[model samples]
Target: MKRKFLLLTTFCMMVLAACAPGGGSDSEESNAVSGDGGSGKQVLDFWYIDPGEKEKVYQEAVERFEEKHPDVEVKMLRVANDAYKQKLAVSMSGGNAPDIFNSWGGGWLKQFVDQGQVLDVTESIEKERFNELALDNTTFHDKIYGLPLGLSLDLVFYNKEIFEEYGLTPPETYTEWVEIIETLKENNIIPIALANQTKWPGAYYLMNFAARIGGPDLFNEAFLREGRGFDDPAYVEAGEYIQEMVEMDAFNPGFNGVPYDEGQGRQLLYSGQAAMMDITMSLVNNVRTEAPEFEEKMDFFVFPTVEGGQGSNKAVGASTGPVWSVAADTENPDLATELIQELTSQETAEAYTNRTGSLTAVSGVEPEDEFVNRMYQVAEEATHLQMPYDQTLPPELAELHKDTTQALFGLSITPEEAAEQMEAKAKEVLE
Candidate 1:
C-alpha cells in the first residue's frame, strides 16, 4: 500500500545492481541487456517480486516465451520482498532500468510514470481483455501503463464454526454488524482480529468505512484534487465509526501488538483465538494448505453496507495491486510488450490460477480454487471495486492516511483531529 522514491541515487543503483539476485540467463551480470541484432537475437531484462513458487511458474512462462520467440532472450531477476521496491526505484530513475518489471499500478507507479520511467503501452494492450476493476490503477490520464497480473479482494473471513456457535450469520447492514460485534463481546469472544503492526491492515477498515459512507466517487474525487479532500464528512465519519468500534473493544485484546504478515493475524483466525478477520483473498491458499480443517470452517462476507449511506451494498473493497509494466527505456519495445501480453493473456491467466490457486485479472480465466472462484464472483458483482485508500492517494498522503488510520484505531487521535491532520497534509502535498 505504500511506495515511492525520494530520488534514485547513482550509489543506490550501483548497490542494487551488485546485490540483486539474477535469474534466467546465468551469464547475465546486470540488466543492461544488449539489443544488437548482430547475433540475430535480442535480450531483455525483467525484474519481478515473486516470493515463492510464483517464480517457478514465471520461469516456465519465460521458457514458453523463449520457445515462441526464438530470437528474443529474457534476463529475469528475482528480488526479495523487502528489497524489491528500493531496488526498483534506483533501477528506474537513476540507472538503466530493466526492460520490464513487476509493479502495483497506483500512486506509487504514478511517481515513476511522472518521471518518465515507465512506458505507455495503450495501443499494445486490449482494454476490454482485462477486468475494468483491475485496470483502474493501470491507467493514468487516459493511457495504459501496465498490465494487471492478479486480483485481491478484502473481506471479512469468519470462522463459520465460531459463528454458528454464537448463532451468527453474516450481517447485511452496519447496525446488524455492530450488534453482532457486541454479542460476540458479551460471549467473551473477540469479534474482529486486528493487526496494525504493518499498518495497512488497519487502513483497510478506514478505506472500507469511507467507501460505505461516501460511495466510490467521493474518495476518488478527493484524491483527484476535488473540493471534498480528506476533510470530507465521510472520511471523518469513517474515523469516528472506527473509534467507536475500538472503544467497544470489538477487536482482539493486544491486537496492536500483532503483526499481520508474520503469521500472527492468520494464526489468530485459524486457531479460533478470534472469530473473524478482514483479510485479502490471497490468504485462501495459505489457509488451504496450512489448515485444511480451518479452511472448511472459513467463509467470507463483504463488508456490510451503511443503512443510509451513499455507497451501494455491492461496492466491495478489492484491488489489482500487482501489475507488470514495461520500462520506458527498453530498446526492444515490441518484444517487451509481447512478453507482457503473453504473461497476462487468457492462457497464462488460467495457468497462473491453476498453479497458484489465485485469481488473475484476465476476464475469462475462472480460477480453479473454489474460494478464489467465489471471490471472482464477488468482484463481478461489485458496483465499484475500490483500492485501499493508502494505495490510491499520492505517496506522502498515502503514508499519512495509513498512520492516521492506525492512530484512529489505537484511539490516540479523535476522528475530527485525524481528518484535520489529513486535510493539512493533503493541502500541503496537493495544493
Candidate 2:
C-alpha cells in the first residue's frame, strides 16, 4: 500500500513540474502570454505604400517610436502603391488587417469607415494642428478617421530651359496655354508628357478642365446628386478640350502606352523631348533624385483659368497624402495612436518636407527650397481644391471615371458619352 501511494505521488509531482513556466520553450512561453508573442514586447503591424526615400522616413519614425516606448515593437511593412488597396482589402476580409495602415483619404478610406473597419480618431487627433484642406479629405460624416500627414497638389511642371529656348513663359489663361502648346508643337517638341496607359494621369486633364470650366459648384452638384450630375455641359466641354489638345498633337507619341508610375513621362521631360507635365508635387523629389542636374531647369505653374469659365484659377486638383489610420480592431489601440503621433510629429514632418520638397500636413511646415516654396504657396492660397475623382468617388464609380477618361484620351469615346457613363455609375452606386 505504501509503495503504491509513493508511486502515484511521484507521478503527480512530475506532471506538475512539466507544466511549470520554465518547462516550456521560449516560443511556447510567448504563446502562453497575453500579447507579448514571446518577445516580451507588444508588437504592432504597420503598413504603408511609400517605397523609396519616403519609406526611409517612416522607418526612422518607427525607430524613434520604439525608442520612446521600449516595451513596444513596430514591424513596418511597405506595400507597393499599385497593390496596396487590393492587399488591404484581402487582409481586412480575412480578419487580418494590420494594426495601422496608410491610406488615401476620401472615398478610398470611406469604404473602410462604412464597414466599421477603421477606428474613429476624432477625439485623439487635434484638428487645429493640421491644415484644414488636408483634414478635409480624411473627414467623413463629420468625424475624423485618419491622421493627415501631407498634401498633394497637381501643377504644370515645365522645363525652364526648354521654355526659354522657345521664348515661352507660363500662361495666365487657358487660351494662352493652348497657344503655348501650339508653339511647342510647331517647334517639334512634345507639348505635354502624359502616361495614360495607367489611366489616372489623363484623368487629371479632364478633372482640371471641368473644374476650370464649371467651378466647384458643378462637381459638388454632380457628386451630391443635387443638380445636373456629371453629364452637365461643363464635363462635356472638358472632354472637348482634351480632344482639341489631342488634335494638336500636344502629347507624346504613344503617350497612351506609357505608364506614369514607371517614370516614363518624367523621362520625356528630362531628355527635353517634352516641355511640360501636369503632375503631383512629388515631381520635385523625382527630379531631384532621377536627374539631379535637371532640378535647376524645373519650374511649375497652376492650371490657368479658362475664358468665360466659372472656376477660378485658384482652384486646384489636390488630395491628401497617405493618411495613417488605426484599425478598429487593433489590440494595442493606445500604442498605435501614440505611434501615429510620433510618425506625424513636427520633426518627422519637417524632415520629410526638407528631404523631398513636398508639403506636409503639419501646420507651418513648408519646403525650404525657393522654387518648391512657390508651388507650396499655390496650394496654400488655393480658393478651392478638388480632390481627384478616383479618390473622391466610390471605388466602382472611380474606376469607371478613370476608364472613361482614358477612353476620351484615346478618342474612342465622346465626352458626352463618358459623362453619361459616369452619371449612370454614380447613380447606381450612390443612390
Candidate 3:
C-alpha cells in the first residue's frame, strides 16, 4: 500500500508540475501594500490553507470588511497545507510576511513567538468568545498570539450501516470497544480504518489513547517534566492496547502503508470494509464529498471510556484548528488585526462552519452539518477537552511519541519500552 500511494502521489505531482507554467520557484513573500491612496484605506494580506468549499465564505467576509472600511483592500492566498508552514517561515525570516497567516497552536507558532515574529492577539481580541480549550492552545508565555477560527476533536467515526449489519452500536467504554472489535473480526470485517503511513493520523490516535489512560493532568505532568520517561505504566498500557488491536487484525490490511489522500483509512469505512475510524471532525466533510451515498450512515462518538483508568468517562482529545496570526513586523498592524476580526467574526464563522462542516471557534455559531454539529455537542459535554499530546508537548518529544507508538504497532518493542522512551524524550524537552 505504501508503494502504491507513493507511486500515485509521485504521478500526481509530476502531472501537476507539467501542467503548470512554471516550476516550484515562486517566492514565499507577499507583495502586500498597506495604506490606501495617500490617506485612503489600508490593504492586508491573509494566507490560509484551502478549507474545502469554504473559500468563498472567507472571501465574502473580506468583501464585507471592504464595504464597511472602504479604504482597506484584503488579499487572500490559499496555500496548500504541506506548504503553509514552510512558506510562512520563509516569509517571516525575509521580513516580507503576510499581514495575517494561519498557524498551529503548539511548536509551529511557538518557534515564531520565540523569534518575535508574531503579534499578540490576546490584547486585541476578546478571548471569552472562543472555547476555553481553543483559547488555551494559542496562549503561550502568558500571551496569546493568534485567533482560532475553528477546532477539531479526535473521536471515533463509525459507519452506521456497518455497525447495524454487525449488531453493534458506538461502544460506550473501552471494554465494550474491545468486544466490538472482536465481533467485527468474527464477521470478517476490519474493526478500524487506520492510515498509519501518514504518521500524523496514527500519532493522534496514540495521543488520544494515552491521554485517556494517564488522564490529562497526569499526562501533562509527565510531558512537562524533564527526565520523565515514556515507559510509564500508563503509557505502556495505552501502547499495549493499541498493539493488541493491531495483532487482532482490527485494522484494514495494509493500513500502516496508506496515505491520507486516496481515501486511505476513510475508504475502508466508506466501502463498508471497516466498522470505525479514529480521526478529526473534518472526516465528516470528506465522507460527505467522497461517499455521499453513505452520508446518512455515518456518525461519530467520543473514544470509549478506558476501563479502570484515571481519565474521566467524558474526557476527550481536541485542539484548536490552525489559527490566524499577524506578522509582528507588518507595515499595518491595525489593518491586520481588523482582518482577523472580520475573518473570525460570527458571520464568517457561521458561513465557514456551514460550508465546510467544521466546528467554529467562535461562540454561539452552531455548525450546520449534522455530523459536525453532533460532534460539537458531544465535545461540549465532555468534562475536559484534553489537547492532543503531540500538540501539547514539545516538538522533539512529540516526534518521539509518534515513533514509539508506531513501533508498538510494528511489534518491534513492548509497550513498556515505548513508554520509557517517551518519558526520556519528554524529560529532555521539558528540562
Candidate 4:
C-alpha cells in the first residue's frame, strides 16, 4: 500500500511540474490562459487613428471580431490625427509597432515597406472585387501591403443660397470658375474661405491645379523620380493658377493669418462670410453639427476642367483615407491579416459609412446623404485619383510643398519661383 501511494503521488507531482512555466507541457507554454485550461490564442495589438466617431464605430467592430474570433484577441489603440504620424514613426523605428496599425499610405507607409516592417499581403486574401483606385494607395509595386478603409474626396462646398445670390452655378470649366471668382470679388464677397496659416488648405488648390494641368502623369513623374520631376511646365502652370487666384483676391481677407482648426475657417463658410470653401468629405457632419441650418444650404462640386491642359477634371482630388497594415514582425500574422480584412470588409465598410458619413471604399456600400452620394459619384467616375503632394511626399518634402504653396497664395513668391522651390524640394525627396 505504501509503494502504490508513493507511485501515485510521484505521478501527480510530475503532471503539476509539466504544467508550470518552462517545465510545463510545451503546449501549455505556447498557449495563453483563458479559463481553467489554456487557449492557443494570440493577441494582436491593433492601432488606429480616431476620426471622431470612429472610436465608437470601431468598438462595435472589435466586439464583433472578438465574438467571431474567440481564440484571437484584438487590442485596440486610438491616436489623434496630428499626433498619429509622429507616434507611428516612433513605434515603427523602435521595433515595437503594433501588430496592425493605421497608415495614410503613399510616402508615409512606403517608409515601413522599405524597412521590411510591413507584411506583403498579396496572397493572404481576396481583394479583387474592391475599387481598384482605392487599392492603388496601399499597393506597393504589385503586392498589396495594406487594406484601404474608405474614400476621402476633396470638393468645393458652397452655400446654395450664396451661389443663387451671385447668379452663378457651380462652374463646369476652369474659365467659368475664374469668372465666378472675379464676380464674387466684384460683389465684395470673399470668394473662398481659406486658412493658409495651416498650409494644408493651400495644398488642396495646388493638388487640384497640378492634376488639372499635368494629369496624374506629372505628379507620378515627380513622385517616382521619373523624367522632368516637379520642374515640369505643368507645375509652373499650376503655380500660375495659384497666383492668379491670389491676384483675384479669391480667399478671405487676412486669410493668411486665420487658423484652420480654431473654427475661424469653417465659420467663414457657415456664417456666409465666404461663398464657397474647398473641403473634405468629412466636413459634411461638421456643418451638420456646428451649423445645422447651413447644412441644408450646403452643396458641392468637383474640380472643373482646365481649357488647355492634358488633365482629366473627372479625376478627384482625394485619398484612400487611411489603411490598416500588418507588421511584418508580428507573431500573429494570421490573426492580424484577418483582423485587417474584417475591418475593411463589406459589412464593416457599410457600418462605418453609416455611422460616420464618410464614403467608404467598398463598392456597394452607399451613404444615405445625397451630398455624400454625389461625392461618391465623383470618386467612382474618377479617371485617376490624385494624392495630394503634402500627403504623398516625405515629411520634409511635404512641408516644403505646403510652404511653397502658402508662399504662392500670400504672393510672397512668384509662380515661377514657387515651382522652382517645389522642384528643388522634389529632387531631394524623389531621389
Best by lDDT: 2
Candidate 4 lands at a TM-score of 0.83
lDDT string for model 2 (86-136, tens) is: 999998875678889998799989999999999988888788889888888
lDDT values for all models: 0.81, 0.87, 0.77, 0.79
Clashing residue pairs in candidate 4 are 18-24
Q: In model 2, what lDDT does residue 138 have? A: 89
Which digits, one per residue and each the tens of the lDDT, describe model 4 over residues 310-332?
78778788877668889997877
User: Over the stretch 291-393, how does candidate 3's per-residue lDDT look in tens digits?
Assistant: 7787788788788768777776577777777588898877778878888888889888888788777888788888767767787787778788777666667
TM-scores of the candidates in the order shown: 0.84, 0.90, 0.85, 0.83
RMSD for each model, in Å, please? 8.9, 7.8, 11.0, 9.6
Q: Clashing residue pairs in candidate 2, if any?
A: 30-38
Model 3, total clashes:
12
Each candidate structure's count of clashing pairs: 0, 1, 12, 1
Query: Against the true structure, candidate 2 has what lDDT?
Result: 0.87
Worst 10 residues of 1 by lDDT: 24-33
